[model samples]
Each structure stands twice: as structure tokens, then as C-alpha cells.
Target: MKKLTSRIDKEKLLLAVAAPLLALVAALVVTALVILATGKNPFPAFNDMLSYGSASDSQVYILNKATTYYLAGIAVAIGFRMNLFNIGVDGQYRLAAFLAAVVGGALSLPGIVQIPVIILVAMLVGAVWSAIAGILKVTRGVSEVISTIMLNAIATAIIAYLLQPERLGQLDEAGTLVSTKPLPESSWFFTLDMGPAGQLWGFIVVAVVVGVAYWFTLGRTRFGFDLRAVGQSESAAAASGANVKKMIVTSMIISGAVAGLVGMPTLLNDSHQFDNSFPLGLGFTGIAIALLGRNHPVGVALAALLWGYLERTTGHFEVIGYDKEILGVIQGVIVLCVVIAYELVRRYGLKRQQQRVGAELAAQAAKTDTEVTA
Candidate 1:
């Protein structure tokens, strides 16, 4: 029994890893085909990407980019684990960042106090925004997908309205752009100077912490089991004494809280203010990353890094005469491949388990027959 259990565990692990690897290989093949169709040698482009991506400066940049993506992926994964598709992560993080920036800018407190305050404010805003969808879903029989989409538009409008000179925004000395008041130098997040490689964001450490917490919460706690149970079957979960409605709301809130952190690496470490230049559409990217990673914490981190590497390398592809659309092609193909690959692996594993069970049962029946004959 112990040996059988160990074998099953190892097989499960292999299948889990195999899905992503298969997807990656499929994506690469498709990308190369596309590039060949474009009348260019695909090998050189791949070689260029690898060389550029491995450079020291590029490594620093990728790490910084991955930090933000890691947070975004985690935020989206939380919702995914509960079978929730939170399309509003983009808006939630944006609004949270803007508010946090406003608060950070207005405060003159020391770094220890001000930084935590800003982070907490971001989390609160994101949670409240996401909760709107959850509340509507439970109380009014609304779909979270639709509600969150609408909330995203509303959040965008609210930010546009508030970020004006007379409101929460201020004109920069350059007179070319309007933005939130800049956070004081005291409020700046710490960084590691990598000398020629550039400065690395300290927020990477925070992202690591968040990943650990996510793993712990979802794998080792009762709430995690309830959440997963609800995701699999709401009726069954309720029959098992779980409060379905409360779990929905709580999960959304927690997901949004993590989404809130998605913007901190940029706001606290780089931009130091909210402005029109603040990145948009990252919430959508989070969806792709979460899916690619199978919603696992460590998997999400690896997916985030892969995303960062692609973005960094593909942007340079434009400079080298490759069409910018290649990036889209690669990303789209990868997502499609991941979905298909995971489904195939899942079915294969299920069939293998069934076969094993059948064999074991047949062996037991044969043993019983022999004993009876004796």
C-alpha cells in the first residue's frame, strides 16, 4: 500500500510538470512556424532573444518586471482557485495605487509608518472594489464576470475624474503631465544597487513573502479546503456545512487585497506617483499567467518570470526588424497550448489511475479464488 501510494504521488507530480513543459514546447513550435511564414529565419530571432534576455541589465529589468507580474498572477490565482474569474483586477489595482499614492504623497510621516499605511490603503481599496462584485453576485443574483467588468469601467472613470489638478492630482514641474502628488523621498521603497546592472526593486522580497503566504493559506488551512470544495461543487460544499455566500465574498476580498499589491513595486519603487503613464491591462495578463501556472504559487512565480522574459526579449525584436505582433502570437499560442495540454494530461492521469485500481482489484479477486480452491 505504501509503495502504491508513493508511485501514485510520483506519477501525479510528473503529470503536473509535464503539462507545462508540453505547452511550452508546443508554443515554441507554433511561434517558429509563424516566424518562418513571415519570411524570416526563426532561429536567429530565438538566438537574439536568448542572448539579450541573458544580459545583466536585462536580467535586472526582467526581475523588476517579474515582481509586479508575480503579484498580479497571485491576485488572479486566488480568484481562479475559487472558480472566480476576476476580470476587474486591472481596475482594482489601478484605483488602489492611485489612492495609495495620494495618501503617500500627502503624508510626511517616517518611512516605517508611511509605507505600511500606503500599502494598507491600497489593500483596502482593492478589497472594497472586488467586494462589490461578490456582493452583487450573492445578493442580487448577478454574475461576478459582468459586475467586475462594469466595476472596471467605473473605476477607470473615477480615477480619471479624481486625478485632475483641482482634485487629488497635481501638475508636475515639467508642465507636460498631470499626476498624483509625488511621495516624499522618505516614503520611497528600498532598492539594491546592482551597479552597472541597474537597481533591483526590494519589493521582490515582498512578492516572495506573499507567495509563501498564499501557499500556506490555500494548502494548510480549513478555509482553503472549504474554498476548494466550494469551487468544485457549491451544492456539495454547502452539504458539507460550508457557508457558500460568505466564502465567495471572503475569497474575492482576499483576491483583491493581493491585487492591490500589484501596483506597489511601480508606485513605491519606481514611479512614486499615479499618472496617465501608469500601466494598464496588467489584470488581463494576470489571467494568462495564472492559467499557465495552473494557479499554483510556485508555478505562478515561474510563469511571471517567463512573461517578463518574453516581454523584455520581444520588445527588442522590433529593433531587430521582427514585427511587434510576434509577441502577441507567442503569448496567445502559449495560452492556447497550456489549456489543451493540461486537459490532455488530466485525462491521461485519470485513465492511468483507473487502470491501476482495476489491476489491484483483479489481483485481490484471484488471490481469494485460489484460497477458496485450496
Candidate 2:
């Protein structure tokens, strides 16, 4: 029994690894074909990307980018685990960052006091915004997908209205752009001076902490078990005495709270304000990363790094006379491949399990018949 169990575990691990590998290979092939159709040698571009992306400066950039991506991925994964499609992550993070920046800019306090306050405000705002969708889903039978998408539009409009010179925003002396007031120098997050390699954002440490917390909460706690049970089958969970409606709302709030952190790396370490230049569409990217990672913490981290790598390397293509649009093609292909590969692997695993169970039952029956004959 022990040997059989060990074998099964090993097989499962192999299957898990195989899915990503298969997806990557398929993506590469498709990308190569697309490049060929464009009358370019894809191998040279691939080699150049590998070389450029491995440079020390590039590594720093990738880490900073991955920090944001990791946070976004975690926020989306939280929703994915609960069988929830939280398309509002973009709005949630943007609103959180905007409000947090406004509050931080208005306050002058010790770093220890002000930073936490800003973060808390962001989380609270994000939770409230997402909870609206959750409450509607549970009470009014509205689809979260529809509500979250609509909320995104509303959030955009609100930001546009509030980000005026007469409102919470400020215009620079040049008058070309409007943004929230810049955070004080004292409130600036720490960084590691890597000399020519550039500065590494301290927010990477925060991302690591978030990942650890996510793993512990989801894998080791009773609440995690209930959440997973409800995700699998809400009716079954309710039959088992779980509060289905409450779980849905709580999960959304938690997901949004994390989503609030997605902009911190940029706001604190680089931009220091919420502005027109703040990244958009990151919530959509997070969905891809979450799917690629299968919603596991370590896997999500790796997927985030991969995303950063692709973005970092692909920009160099334009400088080398290659079309920058290749990035979109590659990313889209990879996501599609990942989806297909995982589904195939899942079906294969299910078939293997069924076979194993049938064989075990047959052997048990044969042994019983032999014993009766004896």
C-alpha cells in the first residue's frame, strides 16, 4: 500500500510538471510559425531575448515587475479558488491606489505611522468595492462577472471625475499631466542600491510575505477547507453546515484586499503617486498568470516571473528592428496552450485514477475467491 501510494504521488507530480512543459513547447512552435509568416528568423530573436533578459539590470527590472504581477496574481487566484471570476481586480486596485495616494499625500507623519495607514485605507476601499459585487451575487442572484465588469467602468469614471486640479489631484508646473500629490520623501519605500544594476524594490519582501500567508491560510486552516468545499459544491458545503453566502462575500473581500496591494510597488517605489501613467489592464494579466500557475502560490510566483521575463525581453525586439507586436502573439499563444494542456492533463489523470481503482478492486476479489476455495 505504501509503495502504491508513493508511486501515485510520483505520477501526480510528473503530470503536474508535464502540463506546463507541454504548453511552453506548443507556444514556442506557434510563435515560431508566426515569426516565419512575418518573414523573420525567430531563433535569432529568441536568442537575443535570452541574452538581454539575463543581464543584471534587466534582472532588477524583471523583479520589480514581477513584484506587482505576483500581487495581482494572488488577488486573482483568491477568486479563482472560490470559483469566482473577479474581473473587477483592475478597478479595485486602481481605486485603492488612488485613494491611498490621496490620503498619503495629505498626511505628514512618521513613516511607521503613515505607511500602514495608507495601506489599510487602500485595503478597506478595495474590500468595500468588491463586497458590493459579492453582496449582489448572493442576495440578488446577479452574476459577479457582470457586476464586476460594470463596476470597473464606474471606477474609471469616478477616478476621472476626482482626478482634477480642483479636486484631489495636482498639476505639475509644466501642466501636461494631473496626478495625486506626490508622497513625501520620508514615506518612500526602501530599496537596495545595486549600483549599475539599478535599485531593487523593497516591496518584493512584502510580496513574499503575502505568498506565504496565502499558502498557509489556504492549505493549513479550517477556513481554507470550508472555502474549498464551498467552491467545489456550495450545496454540499451548506449540507455540511457551512454558511455558503457568507463564505462567498468573505472570499471576495479578501481577494479585493489583496488586489489593493497590487499597485503598492509602483506607487511607493517608483511613481510615488497615482497618475495617468499608472499601469492599466494588469488585472487581465493577472488572470493569465493565475491560470498559468493553477492558482498555487509557488506556481503563481513562477508564472509572474515568466510574465515579467516576457515583457522585459520583448521590448528589446523593437530596438533590434523586430515588430513589438510579437509580444502579444506570444502571450496569447502561451495562454491558449496552457489552457488546453491543463485540460488534457486533468482528463488523463482522471482516467489513470479510474484504472488504478478498477485494478485494485479486481485483485481484491480474486484473492477473496482463492481464500474461499482453500
Candidate 3:
């Protein structure tokens, strides 16, 4: 029995990791089969993706991508923990990015001051925007899901209207795309001198700091406990002296502020300008990362890294005459697999616990019978 329990424990741990591993493997296998069916050599394509993904430049690109995803993932996960479906992250991030770009473009301060100012503005804008949803939910009993979704549409329209050269016009004179003027070089994110890799040191530092802060806030803070209590049962929490309304609003604000940071990697490090085509889909992608990571900060970080790696590698697919859309298929498959695996593992764990309790009860009964007979 001891050996059985030990084996089960090890198996559970293995399953926890293996689920994601298996998902990746399955995605690759399916991709390869698709390539073969198309009469392309999967070996060469896979090799190219692998090589490019590991290259110095690709590593830096992955790091930048990971940073964005990490911030967005944490934002989504925060809402998840509070039982709030904040689909407005896209809108929140867009508004924040626009505000940050505008602030950076208008500012003439030193790098230290200018950059921080821009980031702060972004966070404030995102927080305020998200708070609207929370307020509606608290005061009017509106479902966050409905409110956030509507807010996303409104945000998209606002960005579209603002991107025009006439209204909030900041783009270059030459007709190119919907964009803002480039921020001053002084306000750009600090890059690590990694030769051709082009690492963004600021992103790495910020990601680590945010991760640690988030962990502590959720695990140790009184506010965090109140938020979790509200999430578990709003009535019970309210009865226990917790302010459910305040918790809801607070959770949304924090989630949006975290999401607002997502644009930093692009605005401060990569582009320094707001563009409509500058990967606005990251907010939605963060949802997948949050789900895949099970809303855990460390897990979310790992999930973001995996996503970044896959995204960077997917560019190589274009070289092999394959559409980069293959990455989408892979992502979908992996997310599905991870969700299924998590459910299975959870059920298995519950079953094990039940069995352990049953065994203990049976042993107690047997001992009692023996004692009575003697």
C-alpha cells in the first residue's frame, strides 16, 4: 500500500508536467503529418524552425514576446481568480497603448522620467477603463462578461477613430498605415547588448518583478484574501465583513493595469509607436495562456515562454512554403489537450484521495472487529 501510494504520487507529478509535454509533441506530429500530405519534407521545415528558434536573434525575439504574453496572461489570470471574465483586456490594452504612445510622443523629459511617465499613464488608463466594467457589475448587477465584451467593441472603434491622421493624428506624413509618431529615442526600453540577439533587459526585469509582486499580493495580502473569499462565495464573503463590490472593482483594476503593461515590450522596445496592425490579438491569446497555466503565475510564465517560442519558430514555416497559420492550429491543439489533461488529472487526484480514505476506514473497521473478537 505504501509503495502504491508513492507510485501514485510520482505519477501525479509526472502527469502534471507530461500533459503539456504531450500536447507539444502531438502538435508537432500533427503538423508534420500535414506537411507530408502536402508533399513537403517535414524534416527540413521542422529543422529550420528549430534552428531559427534557437538562434541568438530568435532568443531575443522570444524574450520580448514572452514579456508581452506574461503581462497579458497575468492580467487574465487575475480576473479568473476573482471569478470575473474580463474580456475587455483587448480594449484596456489598446487604450493604454494609445495613451502611452501619446504621452511618450508629447514628452520631452529625460529617458528616466519620460519612460516611467508613459508607463504610468498607460497603467492608469487601463485601470480606469476596466473599473468601468466592475462598477457596472457592482452597482447595476450587469454581468461582467457582457459588459467587457461590449467594452472591447467600443475600444476597437475608439482606437480605429484615433489612429486617423486627423483626429489624434501622430503618424508620419507619408501614407503608410494607422500609426502614431515614433517616441523619442530617450524613452525607449533599455536593451541588453547581446550581440545580434537584441535582448530587452527592461522587459525581463519588469516581468520578474511583476511575477514576484503578484505572487505575494495574492498569497499574503489581506486584500488578496478578501478577493479570493468573494470569488469563492460572494454571499459568504459579504456576510463575513468583506466588501464584495470593492473586491470586484479592485480585481478589475488590477487586471487591467497588468494588461496595460503588455504594450510596453512593443511600445518601448520594438516599435515605439501605436499601430492598428501591431498584434492587437495578444489580449485574446493571453486568455489561452491563462487557461493553459491554470491561472498560476509561474505556470503562466512558462506557458507564455512556450507560446513565444512557437510564435518565433512559426515565422520559419513561411520559408518552407507553409503558411504561418500552422501555428494557430498548433496553438489550438495544445490548449485543448492541456485543458483535457488538467480535468483528467484533477479527477484522478480526487479518486486517489477517496480511495485512501476508504482504505483507512476499512482498516479501522477490521481492527475494531479483531479487538472485539479477542
At residue 345, candidate 2 shows an lDDT of: 96
Question: Model 2 over residues 1-374: C-alpha lDDT tens digits?
Answer: 56667877888999999999999999999999999999999999999989999999999999999999999999999999999999999999999999999999999999998888888888898999999999999999999999999999999999999999999999998999999999998888899999999999999999999999999999999899889999999999999998999999999999999999998889989999999999999888999999989999999999999999999999878889789999999999999999999999989988997788788779889999999999
Task: Give, for candidate 2, the lowest lDDT window spanning 10 residues.
Answer: 1-10
Compared with the true structure, the alpha-carbon lDDT of candidate 1 equals: 0.94
Candidate 3: segments with Cα more than 4 A from true spot: 1-12, 32-44, 171-173, 372-374
Question: Which digits, one per residue and each the tens of the lDDT, describe model 1 over residues 122-172?
Answer: 999999999999999989989999999999999999999999999999888
Clash pairs (backbone) in predicted model 2 = none
Scored by lDDT, model 3 comes in at: 0.86
Q: Runs in model 2 with CA error above 4 Å?
A: none
Tell me the TM-score of each prediction against the true structure: 0.98, 0.98, 0.91
Model 1 CA deviation exceeding 4 Å by range: none
Q: Who is ahead in lDDT, 1 or 2? A: 1
lDDT of 3 by residue, 205-250 (tens): 8888999998999899998888888888999999999988899999
